[model samples]
Target: MSQTNIPLLSLKNISKQFFGSTVLENINFDLYPGEVHAIFGQNGAGKSTLIQIVTGDIQPSSGKIILNNEELKIHSVHKARELGISAVFQEFSLVPQLTVEENLFLGSNNTKGFFLDKKKLHQMACQTMEQLEFSIKPEEKIINLSHAEKRMVEIAKAFHTKPSIMVLDEPTASLAENETNQLFSMIEILKKEGIGVIYITHRMKEIYKISNRITILQDGHVVNTDSVSNINEQKLVELATGRNITNLFPEIKKQRGKKLLDIKNLHISNSFIEDVSINVKAGEVIGITGLAGSGKSAIGRACFGVNKIEAGTISYLDDVIFDSSKQINDISPRAMLDRGMLYLPSDRRAEGLIMEQNIRENISLPSLGLPKFSNGFIVNRKIEKDIVEKIGE
Candidate 1:
């Protein structure tokens, strides 16, 4: 079939429930060939669940999936990939210990009869990387690759088989400015090749720049599906949040307060970062913009006590002090939370949210020590539900 004759993939009234709690209700969606389809929503708006169902990682409770006119019994991820559906989820699936080529062809090692063809695998990975215009060495271990390089490898792997459809979930979340441009160029190449792309991103600029159509989900339901040319970024954000958000990043007046943290000198390994110094003020949001592995997250980690700095004097509040000599356990993530300092990690799937845990458990993870719960030792499930509903708002 030609790219425009029929939708490469379609979902019809797909509804799913976990323990009788409806997660997706009457969800109807479609992805046409050679088009960049964008899905947007707030957290817990069923975007991830719908992606899982489309990728066959989980089956829908009801409704059918049609891929090229074939009804899909999406029971396993293997079957989904075989049917030309590939997803690069927010939580990267790359194995750091393995080389780039090995990670690319980790499974389903295409063989010459009965033996694994290692040479062919390397050749295939190189060809895929070339298609994406990446210059990564095939023999380099994933651990040695920069965060941006790792993300590039993930994209190259997605195109390894030259699948008809590609689903990217926040693929550029950790990327830098130049890397994002390169990735966009690659996405454009894919679209030109008549491959359907489902791009999920929180950034408004990406939607405007790449997508041909936009689909908004609000409170686990489809809110709008319209051509990108028909809707602007302001309207799309309104549809996703169910409110007229004047500014996604609310402006706040800067008040010169006491230095909350002062870092004298800092250095990191693997050439991912170099000598860096900064002092953050109380109630000030210091924006750090850089490519992947430019030490934005590393600096956050060193400040939060997760990473070990080679040399640095971290002074806090002009009184409290934290030096490089301190152990990793000294500034526990929970302790930081208790000290009115909390880290909202970038990896929402792996670091922020627990997929296996239900809504209640995930939401109540950080505030379990409140005195409202049975001497603060036991959880009051009722209070927890109220907290989730509040935060989810």
Candidate 2:
């Protein structure tokens, strides 16, 4: 049978429940070889849950998975990969201590006699990265690389598996415009190679650019599945959110306060950024854009005192906190936080949030010892919960 006649994978009546709460209800989806199927949904709309079940990260409460027209019961991510299902999600699945080459073949049994051929693995990693069109060092440790570089390594790891079905969740979330273009090119290549792809992204343009079909999920139900050409961006948004785009983001007006931050002649140590300057007002939103590894994040990290500043002047509220010329660089993250400045890193799993902690705990961490959430190191659970709930609202 041809690839179009027979689906590469299918899910029938897939239902998932966590502690009596239904996540996915009677979900049915399919992918054909060489097809780019885009899954669209709002947060908690069961998109991630369905993908997790397909890739074996989570099991469905009741369902049937058919792979190549045969029953499939994927119980683990590793087993899924071995069975020609590879995935790279927003949360990177990489060992921080391991090098890129090691991470690429981390769980695979591509060795003999219970020993790994490190040299061969390095060569293979080099070729794989090249094939993916990513400029990353195979010997570099995941922890030492920047957020974008780490994302590239994750993409390379998934692509190296040579899987029949590849899952990419927010692949361009950490990537630059040029990097995103490269990824789109890679997707075209995958389509030609007859590899089915399950893409999950929020970028509306990507749906028409790469995906052949789109499936929208809303409140644990399959809202609709149709060809990309059949749906417009506004229609997709309405279906996914159950509201018009205008209702989702209503117009709001705010008065601009005095200059809040000013960066001039910024230069990051060991990076290519130099002679960069930016000014931000209280109500203004500043966006930094460039190619991957172009120091877009370097500027933010420098302001937060995470990256070393070779030469720069960072002024907060007209006070020079980081001035390389005056040797006045005694700033730290804690000091900035104490000054009412909070910095949220790009990598949530590695930096922003504590993965082991619950959502309430993570949100309450910043104010753990503060008067609102605690009293003299003793936490006030009720008060903290109220404040967190209010913040959520």
Superposed Cα deviation of residue 327, candidate 1 (Å): 14
Model 2 weakest lDDT span, ten residues long = 243-252
lDDT of 2 by residue, 91-162 (tens): 877899999999999967668578988888988999998887778889989989876778778877888878
Candidate 1, residue 196: the lDDT equals 93
Each model's C-alpha lDDT?
0.83, 0.87
Relative to the unseen true structure, what is the C-alpha lDDT of residue 15 in candidate 1, on a scale of 0 to 100? 95
Clashes of 2: 0
Per-residue lDDT over 1-393 for candidate 1, one digit per residue giving the tens place of the 0 to 100 score: 134768999999999999999999999999988989999999999999999998888999999899998776878888888898888876778998999998888877588889878899888888888877898999899989876788888888888877899999998877788888988999999988888999998888898899988889998899999888888777877888788978866867877788887777776544365668888987787887776656678877766766766765766666445566663224557766777777887767767898998988977888887676435667788888887888889
In angstroms, the error of model 1 at 159 is 1.6
TM-score of 2: 0.84
Question: Candidate 1: where are CA atoms >4 Å away?
Answer: 1-3, 112-114, 245-259, 264-277, 310-312, 323-338, 345-393
- By summed lDDT, the worst window of 10 consecutive residues in model 1 runs over 320-329
Cα deviation in Å at residue 301, candidate 1?
1.9
